[model samples]
Target: MKKLMMTATALALGAGMAAADTIRMGTEGAYPPYNFINDSGEVDGFERELGDELCKRAELTCEWVTNDWDSIIPNLVSGNYDTIIAGMTINDERDEVIDFTQNYTMPDPSAYLALSKDVDVDSGVVTAQTGTIQAAFVADSGATLVEFATPEETVAAVRNGEADAVLADKSYLVPIAEEDDSLVLLDREENINMGIGMGIRESDTELREKFDAAITSMKEDGSLNELIKKWDVGATFD
Candidate 1:
């Protein structure tokens, strides 16, 4: 993409901008209400707004860069970007690889969908968004597993009978299922992920603290919860 090529070139040229001075915010611009590529092909969404505010509060110059979800963390570790503002879940497994600021958002509410109740919730052909625990669950559940790049595609898989069911977050699926008569939100639910946080490398303790303090400020001032409500991000700060 134009953004990707431009970012690579800037990094290669050493742009004379110290990496520590101008932070690059990386995201998987595919998940909506979280991060997504807009109609203008620019990254835009809740995470985008949140990241910008955090940068402003931290008094840091920031640039936005989008990457595939599958490679977002690895790329961050590889020094392709300075910070990950993607909606990554904070967990023991990932924390071992990279440090995380305190959670900015709560656990994502996950759900399963099917065409009808007859579609087996278990042991049936299952479709899930790729690079997720849901996909892994399906693969390990003895069901025929199908993976899709986006959450929307996973729902489509069920509609077209490509798979008997789909496992995804409720926030993304609820809007779609409510509008379509064919989509069924199954009773089954999951909360596999913990809270969401900004991913930082182990050595970037100063950078991490800045964002953490900024997040604390927002939480205390109630701005973060307001955004959570406006974006329908479910469960604001207590």
Candidate 2:
């Protein structure tokens, strides 16, 4: 789940989970292997299953909601949902506006997918989803960065020859690379952020702690790593 644009600075959410017993878990519902909408029109993938388990462990009644990646944070702070179980990275920029549970997985390596093995990652046109860390990396790497609104578009840019490569999480791109003979992952990778965690509002300390405890339990019990192995979605905990 490559998430958030960081433009949502001022959030208007008041108290956290005040009126309901059910907590709304917000997700992008598009990033596959991590998250996506299944044919049944339901949220599915590693995060979906992981979120359900965490909610169960926390003894919280949770319902899922879908949001676009660009506005996920703003909507979370605006009270549209109670928590973002959306494979969001925990970082200083994001922590400024919302709290996060302990990381449930290790940092995912950002990998490059190109049309050819000979493409110069440093000098060629590269595409990335707007607001992602991969996009930020491209902006500073001397490559001409092409920003797309969706992850699908970034990959499409490479296929259409609009970009020489696309940078994204390896887990997300690995499936595509295997499915398409035209795409190949470059030899190098970029390790980004503190790893994936559930995002909650700043005021939701109680909720945060609850999920944190649940995550701790999962990590310690070794189930988290098992899930990671099952989905092949990024690195696992020790």
**Global Cα RMSD, each model:** 6.6, 6.7
Question: lDDT tens string, model 1, 69-109?
Answer: 77778898888897788777787878898889999997877
The list of candidate 1 runs beyond 4 A from truth reads 1-19
Error of 2 at 149 (Å): 1.6
Shift in Å, residue 176, candidate 1: 2.0
For model 2, residues 28-125, the per-residue Cα lDDT tens digits are: 99898889999999999999999998877766778999998889999999999999987687788788898888888798899999989999989989
What is the C-alpha local distance difference test score of candidate 2? 0.85
**Model 2 residue 26 CA deviation in Å:** 0.3
Q: Relative to the unseen true structure, what is the C-alpha lDDT of residue 217 in candidate 2, on a scale of 0 to 100?
A: 80
| Superposed Cα deviation of residue 96, candidate 1 (Å) | 1.9
Q: Give the Å error, residue 194, model 2.
A: 2.2
Position 217, candidate 1: lDDT: 87
